[model samples]
Target chain A: MTAENVTAADPDTTVRAPVPSERRGPSSSAPRMLWGLVVLVAVSALALTTDGFVSVANARAILSSVSFTGILAVGTVVIMLSGNLFSLSIGTSAAVSSMLFLYLLPDVGFVLAVLLTLVAGYATFALQGAIVGRLDGNAIIVTIGAGALQVGAVTWLLPGSVQVPDGVDIGFLTRSVLGLPFPLYVFLAVALLVQCWLHYSATGRQVELVGENKAAARAAGLPTGKLVTVAFAVAGLCTAITGILLAGFNQNANLAVSGTFTFDAIAAAIVGGSSVIGGRGSAARAVLGAVIIATIANMLLLRGFGTGVRVLVEGIVVVLVVVAAQRRKRSIA
Target chain B: MTTRPGMARLARRSRRGGLPYVLLVVMLLVFVVLPVVAGQQVTSFNYYNLFQVFASLGLLSVALGLTMIAGEFDLSVLGTYAFAGLVAVKLGADDPVVGLLAALVLAALIGALQGALVAWFRLPSAAVSLGVYIALLGLTATISDSKTVPYNNLNVSDVLDRQYLEIFSLRSIIAILAVAAIAVTMTYTRFGRDVRAIGSDRRASLRIGVRVDSILVVLFVLSALLSALGGSMLALSLAAATPDPGFDPLIFALTAVLLGGVSLRGGTGTVLGIAAGILTLSLLRELLTVLATPTYVSSLATGGLLLVVAFAAAPGLNAWWLSMRRPTKRVAEPPSLSRVG
Candidate 1:
C-alpha cells in the first residue's frame, strides 16, 4: 500500500507520535555519528599506512564490491526490523532471481526480463512472509526451507549457469557513472529511499511498531500481518535489485552468484548496530555497515591476509556488536 | 490422582497423535514399495546404501534436534562438521582414534564457548551460533587452505565401510547406537525433562529450578560432539575431507528435525521420531537413486517436503482447521472466556 492510503485510513491518528523518538533523537544520532567518525578515522589511518590504499582506483573497487552486499544488507534491515530475525535464504533468493533474469534475457529484452525477475522475487518472499505472519510459522525455519526450495528448484530447472545472449549488450548496466560504478548509485538510491520511507511513511512506522512489540501492536488493532508482508516484499525487491546488478556485472548467473551474501549481509546489518531483536535499525546505517566491512576487507587484502582471516574478523565483529548491543539494551531496560 | 488423570491423558493423546511414525510408514511405503512394484529388486545392498547415507546425516539431525528441543539452534553444526572432518583427515594420518578425539575435543570447546555466550548474556542462540558458524568455517578454510585433505590410509576407509550381516557397516552401527543412547537419555532422564521444560517455557522452568544455564551449556556440548563424531566417521570412511561440505547436509538435517515433528517453537518431539525422520529421508534418497533421477530432484524433494511439513505444523493452520471442523463450538465460546475463568 502507498503512503496516501495509510494517511487516508488513519487521519485521526495523526496526533500520535509519527516516529519513535529514540530512533531519531539527537542523543542517539550523536553517538552513532561519533562511532562512524571513529571508524572513518581508523580506516583513513590504515589507508595511509598501506601502499596504494588511498588511490581512486582502490576507492572505486571498494565501493563496487560493497554495492551488492550493501543493497542486500539494507533489505535484511527491513526483515530484521520486522522482527523476523534474518532470512538465511537471501543468498539463494538472489541467486534464483539472477538466474531467472538471465534465463529470460535470452527470450525477452533486458527491461522486461528485469521486471519479470523482480516480480518473481517479490512473490516468492511475499509468500514466505504470509507463511510467517499469517500461519505463525517460525520465520527463520520458513526462510531456510524456502531457500532450500529455491535452490533445489533452480538447480532442477536450470542445470547450469545462465548467460546473456551473444547479441545482447548490457554493458551499460555495469558501466561507471561519474567515476562511480552504477551499482553504487543504485545502492545509494535504495538506501536513501528506504531510509526516507522508514522515517516518513505511515506504513513503515507501523512496521517498526509491529517489530518493537508484536503483541502490543496486535492489541492496538494494527495490521501487523500486512506490515510484516510489506516488509518482506520490500526485502524481496532489494534482493532482486542486487541480483540484477550482480548478473549485469558478471554477464552470467549461477547458484553460486552470491553464496556468501546471506552471512555477509547479516554481519553488516549486525555490525551497523541494527538490533537483531527487531524494531531498531535503519537502511542508511546498514549501508554504512556494508561500507565498513568492505573497507576492512580491502585493508586486509592489501595487507596480504587470506579470505579465512577476513571471514574470521567479520565473525568476530558480528559477535562483538551483538554482545555490545545486548548490553546496551539491558542497561536501557 | 487428579494429576494422574491429566498425565495419563497427555500420554494417551501423544501416542494417538503419532505423526512421525505415520509419516515414516507412508514414506517407506512410497519409496520402497513403489520401486519394488516397478520391477526393481530391493536388495540388502540397497538397505546398506540407505543406512550408509543415513549414518552421518542422521547424527546431524539428532544434534540439531537436541538443541531445538532445548529451545535453541546450532547453525555451527555445519561448520563444525567440515572442520572436524578436515582435522581428522589431517591429524589422523597415523592413528584414526587420536584424530577423532582431537576433533571432538576441539568441537566441545567451541560448543562450550558458544553456550557460555548464549547463557551468560541471554543472547539469541541463532545469532550467536551463526557467528560461531562463520568463525568455524573460517577455521576450516584456514586449516585446509581451501583444498581437499585426503587421508593417507585407505585401510581405515575399507574397515569402516565393510559390510556386516549383509546390511550394516561399522559406521552405520555406531550411528544407530549413538542415536539409541541419546534417545534413552532424553526419554528416561531428569535432564531430558528439564530440557523439554526449558523449551516449553524458559521462565517457568527457571522458576521451578531447572538449572537452565548449565543445562544449556551441556546440551550445546553434546550437540557439537555428535556433529564432530559424525563428521570424523564420514571423513575416515571416505578417506578425504574438504573445506566446504556444502549446505545440503544442513538443509537435510533441518528437514529431518522438522519432519520428526519437532516444533520450531520448541518443547515437543521424540528422539525416536527423529530417527524415523532420518530413515524416511535416507529411503527417499535411495528411491531416487534407484529411479535414476537427477541429483537435483533429491534436493527438490527434500526442500519441498520441508516446506510442506512446516506449513502443516503451523499453529494458525491447525487452529483454523479445528475451527472449521467445530464451527459451532467456536461460536459458543468467547476467546477471553477460553483463557480465563
Candidate 2:
C-alpha cells in the first residue's frame, strides 16, 4: 500500500521532528539516487557473471517457485501489519489443508474440494484472529497452541499414510499458459488484487490504521478488532490456496514438507522489507522478497548441497538479511 | 465518559481479587480434578507423567518467554535445541563434556547472531528467526543425514534410561536446577529488569537510559542457551536426536508458558507460573493417555484446551465482560485520538 507522504513545508520543521537521522537526507536527489546505483550495480554484476540467472526460462521457473511463498508472504504481511506476530499455525494449517485436499479429492471433485478448503482456512484463521485481537490474546501463543492441535489432527486423521489418488489432475491450475506457469499467473493476479484491496479499499485503509496504532484506531471508532480478524481470514484463504497449488505442483500433498514452507514464507516477507511492527508493507515488496529467498533456495539445490546444506545456507542468508534490515531500521530511528 | 469514577474504581478493585482466582479454580477442576475423580491410578500417574513432560517442556517455554517478553520472537530456539542435541549426541559419544560444550557454544552463537541482528540492527526477530529456523532445520537434517542419531553409547543410554531421570524423580535434578537458576536470573538480575522494562514499554525504557538493545541481544543468547541445554538433555533421555522433536518443544513449551499466565505481550507472569503451567499441561496429557481415549480424540481435546486457555489467558478477558454490568466506569477516559497524532 502506498502511504501518503506528508512532507514538511519548511526545512526547519523537518530538522525539528524526532525523525531518525538515517532516514533523512537532502530531500532532493540523494537517497533514491544512491539506491538506484546499488540496483544498477547488482544487475550489472548478474549480467556479467552468472549463467542463465536472467534468462526468461529461469525467470519463469523462479516465478513458479515463488508463487506459493509469495501468496503466503502477502497474507502474512496483512496480519503482521495488523500488529500480530507469526501465525504459528500457518504451516500446519497449510499442511492440513493440502492433506485434506488429497484426502477429499476422491469424495468431492477437485474444484469443490479446493473451494471448501478455502472456506475452512478462512474460518480457522478468522477465529484465531478474533481471539487474538478482539480478546487481546497473544498471537504467538495462540498460534503455537493451534499449530500443535493441527499437527495432532493431521497425524491422527491420516495416520501412517495418505496420498492423492492417481490419474486425477488439475491441469487448469498447474499447466503453463504463457511463458509462466498457471500458478505464477495466479500468484500475480492475487498479488494485484491484494495490492488493490490494500491501497484502494476502505477496509484496507482501516487495516493499516489499526496496525499503525490499534488503541488509537479503536479510540477513533475504527473496528480494529474486526479488521484484524479479516486480515487473518484473508491470510488463511491465501495460505490455503497456496497449499492446494502446492499439492498440484508436487502432484501429491505431504505433511512433512509443511515446515519448510512456513519458515520460508516468513523469510520472504522479512527480506522484502515488511515491518514486523505492523502497518508498513506492500504486496509487491513481499512477493519480491519471496522470490529472492526462493531463488536462493533453488540455487542451493542446483548446486547439489542437499537438504542440510541448503538449510544452513538459507539460515545464514536470513541472518544476513535480518542484520541488514535491523541496521537500517536502527539508523533510521 | 459519563460513568462515575468512584464506582468504576470499586468495581475494578473487586474484580482484581475475584476473577483470576475463580478462573484458575475452574480450570484446575476441569482438567485436573475430573480426571482424578475418575480413578486413582488413572489420575496420579497421568498427572505425574504430565508434570514430567511439562517440566522438560517448561525449560524451553521459559527460554522462549524470556525473549518474547522483550518484544521479540525467537523461532531459532528450535534449531538451537536440535543442533544442541545433535552436537551433544555426536560429541558426547566421544566425550560428554566435549558434547555439552559444543552444543552450548553452537546454541550461544546462533543466539548471538540473531540477537545482535534484532537488538543492534533493529530487525524483527520473528522474520530473522524464521530464516534461522529453516537454516538450522536444514543443518540438522544434513548433519544427522536426515535420520535419527541414536545414543549408542551404553553409559549415556543407561544414564538416560534410568527411571530416576524422569520428571518427579531425582534424575530430574537437572530440571529443578534449571528452574531455580531461571527463577534467580529472571527475578534478581539487572538484565531481567531491563527485559521487563523494555517489553513493557520500549520507548519509555530507552528514554530512562536502559541499554535496551544489548539487553535484548544477551537475553536472546541466554534463551537459546537454555533451550539447547534442554534439547540436548531430551535427546540424551530419548537416546536419539530427531529433526522433528524440536517442533513439539517449540509449540508445547510456549503454550504452557502462555497458559501459566505469561502474557505474549510480555512484562507479565513469573517463572513459577510458567513451570506450573507446564506441569498442568503435561498432567493433562498423561491423564488423557491413561483414560484410554481413542487415538483421534486427544488432538481435538488439546485444541479445545488451547482455545479455552487462550481465552482465559487473554489480557483483561475476565473483567472485560463482567465490568459491563457494573454500575460504575472511568469518567476521564482518553478521548479517541487521531490515528497518527
Residues A1-333, candidate 1: write the lDDT tens digits. Answer: 233434433432332233344445666667665665776797679867988788889989999999998999999999999888888889889888988988998888888999999999899989998888767777777888888788888887875899888999988879989888999999999999999998899998888888876755654667776888889988999999989988899999998886678888999888887888686899988987898889888988999988887787788778767765554232221
CAPRI-style docking class of model 1 based on DockQ: acceptable
Clashing pairs in 2: A81-A279, A311-B135, A326-B121, A326-B123, A327-B121, B50-B282, B50-B283
Q: What are the per-model C-alpha RMSD values against the true structure?
A: 5.8, 6.1
For model 2, the docking class works out as acceptable
Global lDDT of each candidate: 0.83, 0.72
**Model 1: clashing residue pairs?**
none
TM-score of chain A of each: 0.88, 0.83
Model 2 complex DockQ against the native: 0.41
Off by over 4 Å in 2: A1-57, A102-111, A154-169, A257-259, A328-333, B1-55, B69-72, B164-171, B188-195, B203-214, B316-341
lDDT of 1 by residue, B1-341 (tens): 79999999899768635877887899878976798788777788998987887779888889999999988888888888888898898889899989999999999998898888888777888888888888787777777787888898999999899999999999999888988999999999999999999998887898788998899999999999999989989998999997887678888898888888787878988789888889888888788888878777777787787778778777667655666898754311222433444
Best by TM-score: 1
Residue A121's lDDT within candidate 2 is 88
Q: Work out how many backbone clashes candidate 1 has.
A: 0
